[model samples]
Target: MLKRKIEIRLRPDGEIEAEVKGFKGKKCTDYIAFLEELLEAETIDSNYRAEYYEQEVLLKDENKVLESIEVIPESILKASNKK
Candidate 1:
């Protein structure tokens, strides 16, 4: 799993600052978009390293599994792509 963390700092002057860590690739932009919309804040600047463009993904195939009941793995059930 990609580890993600966000920190918020509220200054005495009512300005807010957010720090996002541990996100890779366009994931960082996705994270920032959600946070900015949630807080209605404008991003003044961003700092990113080469690692920021790398993404972490996990894939699993569920056709093979031992089950006692009609159980489905959470990952398969909650897959973002479904028709």
Candidate 2:
């Protein structure tokens, strides 16, 4: 079983930061798209964790595998968008 988590932090300077965990590959990005759009934020830099490189096997006999995945935390994206 795979678990998805999102952690959000508010800074003293009125900045928001978000961290995503347990999301494999592009799913993390897809999950946060709505938040980014809602906050009118743009992504500046992205760091993919080791988990992102992990490949998921859907079926053993079928040999079906998912593609490489990467995700950007919300807080990092918001910080970069600030100028």
Candidate 3:
């Protein structure tokens, strides 16, 4: 399971900004709606990070974020693509 997080900031002008992380694809949208209703404020603007476009690939009892990354060689990647 992804370790999801939401960082919400209350601006000086009382504008609310929330950055939702670790939720793949459009999963963050549900939280946005919840915030809007909870705060009784209409969202005037929104932005998505690159992660927002990625769909979650689930593996049972697996978390995708590795404790360490193992770099793959370009040659290996190219060879795999040919198959």
Candidate 4:
């Protein structure tokens, strides 16, 4: 997984400033593009580092491991309901 830190600072002039660190390549800029779009503001400035494009892909596999499980009865759910 890629690790990075994003800092947002609100200035006295009502301007918001953002800084991204530990990310490299176009990854940092590309990732933050959504923020600018969400806020409906143009990017005034940006700085990029080289580590942003690298990320580890985790392999997730599911295996059925069945074991005896006990479940609480439906009467408990009705008893806990306030309405």
Quick one: best lDDT, which candidate? 3
* Local distance difference test scores for all models: 0.66, 0.66, 0.73, 0.58
Which wins on lDDT, candidate 3 or candidate 4? 3
Task: Give per-residue lDDT, candidate 1, residue 32.
Answer: 71
Q: In angstroms, how far off is 81's CA in candidate 4? A: 75
Candidate that beats the other on lDDT, 1 or 3, i.e. the better one = 3
Could you give candidate 4's per-residue lDDT for residues 1-83 as a string of tens digits? 23577787878997778877755445466657876876667787665433444443324574332332233335755887845
Model 2 TM-score (2 dp) = 0.55
List, residue by residue over 1-83, the lDDT tens digit for candidate 3.
55788788999998988878877666777888888888889889999766665565545578553332233456867999999
Q: After superposition, how far is residue 69 of candidate 2 from its true place, in Å?
A: 11
> Which segments of candidate 4 are over 4 A away from where they belong?
49-83
lDDT of 2 by residue, 38-70 (tens): 667755556767676554546667866544434
**Local error of candidate 2 at residue 51 (angstroms):** 0.9
Q: Candidate 3: list runs displaced more than 4 Å.
A: 58-83
Q: In TM-score terms, which candidate is top? A: 3
Residue pairs in collision within model 1: 25-52
- Among residues 3 or more apart in sequence or in different chains, the pairs in candidate 2 whose N, CA or C atoms overlap within 3 Å are 17-75, 18-75, 25-69
TM-score of each: 0.57, 0.55, 0.62, 0.47
Steric collisions counted per model: 1, 3, 0, 4
Better of 3 and 4 by TM-score: 3
Point out where model 2 deviates above 4 Å. 60-83
**lDDT, residue 34, candidate 4:** 71
